[model samples]
Target chain A: MIHFFNDIARTRLTRWVFGWLFLVLLYQWSANLMISQLESPVLLRVDLDLTYWLVHLTGIGEFFRSSYFAAFSFDFFLTVLCLVAVLFPKRTIVPILTGLFFLIYCVLLNSYQCWHYHNLITLILLIVPFCFRSLKTFSILFAGLRYAVAYIYASAAIWKLVRGSVFNEGQMKWLIQHNYVDRLAVEGYELNFLENMMFQLSNYSTLSSIALIIGVAMEASFLIAFFTRKFDRHLIIIGVVFHLITAVLVDVSFLQLWILFLVFLPPDRITSSPTTWFQRQKA
Target chain B: MNFFLRDVWKQSKIVFAFFVAFILGTIWCTFSKIEITPFFLWAHYSDKQTPTGKFERIYIKVNGEILDLPKFSRATREMIQLPTEYFVQLERTDYNTNTRQLIQKKFASMMSQKSLQKMEGHLCNSKEDKNAYLYWMAKYIERVTGKRVLTLEVGTCELLFKPDGTVARENFIFVAKFSRA
Candidate 1:
């Protein structure tokens, strides 16, 4: 474990992961999706998740929801912790606290939104390995994280197959019409390039069914990762393309989940050169 | 893989235990059709959907002006849509009384009456709850649009999907309306 931690390659990977996460935090804040910008939202719905029920029943969640100052302070503290974790990549405690606070933020946000959005799940899982200082531990957790991502996609495909949705010819056409009814109903509501393409594709049953099969096939492709690492880069590309297609067609942005792609980065490819004092010491 | 697992077991028993638990929990959740956070059912878009010909869409009008929700950002759109959908669901379920009764009949053996009551209390959705949500939504719309909302009207518009790839809006039914004094 010590030998693995002392290696410069692992240090570069650690810095890169935290650096990417810090950027995601900044983007979320600017988009008004951060906890501080929520302005003491009123909780409307809670999921069946026991943790969610406990937080609300214990009044801990209500305390944060009713007080803007407390929520803002919490967000500020979390941001500081993330920044510290990024600056000092070797510090285990900071990432651990960051992960805990971010998990709370995700649960509260979902409760307030009255819906379960799975986009941030990837970010939450990616933060786990950073909480451990040992590279051996990191590798184990990172490998597990990779499999988790693969399972998410592979399982989604399996569900579709098991439920026989993939065989339904009208499934994608109906989904497109249902999801975009508002846009389609509005007169002269301009559709973007991708939206226009999807709408056009939905016009023909054969075309729409083909698109649906292609999507399921792409998801099923992740099953290969569990068997071999040779196609990791290819899997990374497929993941990005899948998300892009979902974002444009369904209007669900899984951009935050893209952080999990960092898991595919081989340690040697993480950095071209080690320029930091920590790397120098390791060398 | 064997070497990695051996190393994980030797280096950190806690992480190894967590991995075992996670794997087992994921399988259980998959089969039992329940989500326990961290372990989730990724069955999104898996349901077989058929063409209903007509679909009901929630429409929001602020200060007598129709609000185009698709024009807003994703976060803003969700903020406006999800709670309104929840409100509509509550109305359809008769303020959750029907749903509560259904659950009571279905899971009476698994859950105690006191536990069932506790669940019902957490999900209490009376008319007052609807009003509170409407009030909050009105303010949220004002904040997002930067326009003071004198009146907020929440309604459902039935959209008819034509076979020729065109959609027409049909009956607009008022579900709820809130006015600020």
Candidate 2:
């Protein structure tokens, strides 16, 4: 088992995958750490995670005291270790340690009820080391990652359809007024292009209908990959454009989703492009 | 320590089946409206439907002074950084507390009688509840302003919209308050 895993880890594709996961973790962790540092420290420091509860559960709750500083320090250390593990993948055990530390971090976040669905992508990273042990396992895990992406979109589209009025012009107006405007008003910001567009299109049923249809189609586009991988790039492009449009229209940013979509881009394609270009230039 | 790839292939098949089942179950649950544990895959599908066209302003006070809580303010920006629903729910739960009521009264005392009269809704209804929200706010303000806050207050400035694009603006009205317990 050890030999099989080490052999697979040495591969260029496995290295590239780990590198991508590391980047995602680094970006997310660093951004979160920075923001938390700048924010009001009031109850934030007092907020306890599972580690605290676990200590208490074992009858040592008195001895296992934790504060915000402990949580912040642990997370910051894990973030640094994750980057180090990626850089020194030759120490295969380091990557595993990074994954384990991250799992612990996730547990702590959950204790605070702060865990979100997107955090599951980190679970994929945790399994990466184990999954790459052999060709068959690698294939299964790769496909599983792709399925996770598709599931996110399909489920979102289904929920919207269930809501029934998401396609209506009035629905668009409600969204703009209640969410975007109310939020912006609190922050003393003016409307942006997306808000302006929603306002103008709110009274036009036909245009709103077209916009709604396009949104659903874009979200559900990943379903095509389930049938065949023929149009993966097109699917990814559509997803990117959709997210970018939403980022502008509403203050909500799905930047992490963009990173997850990289699973659709074959590692060889990404790795080979720079080498192939250099070879052509040399020729 | 090399193993036969055939064994790996068989194991992979089981894993693949598990993935398929999980994905299918999630989709099925969405349609069936069945309760799912952990709720890690909601995809932000909650309806965002709300009446538009009204302008609103939320204000925050620490101690006796009102602070800039507009979008550019660090405190407001950080609070909104949480999920939209979570932020709103936190406010709803936090505002109806004993310390918040004291802060609300402090806000009323600071305001002119005419301004207090114009204020609509019960800011703090002399109700005594838990002090968790106030403690949190004091801690928050101490961190932001680098001083221990003795009291805090919150207010909202609302503007009602007319059909003709005209707005009837209301000045700052007390919403809730927090004080050190």
Candidate 3:
């Protein structure tokens, strides 16, 4: 079984996935900056970043304590440099910088509790470029990434299933009626186009219930990716559509998870299929 | 050719063994409440699972002006941390040591008992564990909005709904009060 798994993990497509993921990280960082302006004197002492213990032990806590702007600058600069360094994978510094950059970014994000989970998929995807060296390492990293993504989806599905609220028609209707409608009312804003749509969806309980069920089912279907490559591309498409719809309706975008889903694309088909088509056209 | 094949086989076996162990460990940790670094096994949104069925309409009054909870909640969600169970957890950890040291060293004079008490009610923790978070959160609001938050009051309205989607009852819960001198 181990030998069989090794064969399954071998791929020439890993590098492309690496490139795609790096691009997504840049977008994630940019979106975060746009949403939450990390201004100068952006005080860091308040929140529990989990990096405090390590910083204290190393006697370098002072550097992070004050000069909030400096911390943000260093994090952003290192992230940019790491993205550039990724293209030069042969250099030893590339991997080192990748690891260092990821650590800094994690610490910076952990300062805010809500933002901690935003880029989790990106962090997991980074293991490939940061950890693997020779071709032999590819199998291990691919296996790890595959399992990590699968586990995230599976765990979410299991959680929803156990909760039972996801299956109950009340969950979506409740969210729409209570959180959004009440929130809009308190904010003194009339229900605009999207909000009105959500309200209408809530009015038709059956539609919202069906939407919620499909969403949960789509998440649950990710388990198939772990066991077999079949339907992987189709699942990625479903995931993308699902995220796009949610982004429109709820203003919640899971772009990071969407990019990570690109890993499920069959690498050989992606890289070679175009060229194969061209050759067939000529013949 | 033979030597090359043998080396590949050996490497593959080693890598595959490690992968197997990791997969098994992640599966095990999913069911158990264990915190491990670099390998987070669970992605359970606990809040979603156990539905409270109450829409939290929280309002805060800083100084003499009233701050709307919905707008406050939105802004806080984007910029400042919202007062969720997650925020409380963050408070518990940061207040363990660094916050007190920070207050004593630099922010001692700025501290106010009224504000501290008010912030305490928002967090689900002990008095000692509460001070650092409350003080910092108060200071954070001041810095971010450039508003002098003299006194703070948090009021929560638990809005329930009937099965047919009509409003059931709005129960107002006054949670906290803080004053900074």
Clashing residue pairs in candidate 3 are B114-B179, B115-B179
If both were scored by TM-score, which would come out higher, candidate 1 or candidate 3?
1
Model 2 regions lying over 4 Å from their true place? A1-65, A90-95, A103-132, A183-205, A270-273, A277-283, B1-14, B24-39, B46-59, B63-130, B141-150, B154-176
Among all windows of 10 consecutive residues in model 1 chain B, the one with the lowest summed lDDT is: B95-104
Scoring model 1 with DockQ, what do you get?
0.48
Please give, as one word, the docking class of candidate 1: acceptable
For candidate 3 chain A, the 10 contiguous residues with the lowest summed lDDT are: A1-10
Q: After superposition, how far is residue A259 of candidate 1 from its true place, in Å?
A: 1.0
State which candidate has the highest DockQ: 1
The local lDDT score (0 to 100) that residue A182 gets in candidate 1 is 81
lDDT of 2: 0.50
What is the lDDT, from 0 to 100, of the residue A147 in candidate 2? Answer: 56
Q: DockQ of each candidate's interface versus the true one?
A: 0.48, 0.13, 0.15
Across A1-283, the per-residue lDDT of candidate 3 in tens digits comes to 1112222233334344345546755655554432123432122332232243343334232354456665666656655655555455444455566666555555444433333454442454545534555554654455346546766676777777776767775677665664564454343456668767766786677888798787778778888865676787787787788777766555555665565665576655444557786886799
Candidate 2 CAPRI classification by DockQ: incorrect
Best by lDDT: 1
- Residue B89, candidate 3: how far off, in angstroms? 8.0
Off by over 4 Å in 1: A1-10, A271-283, B1-7, B97-125
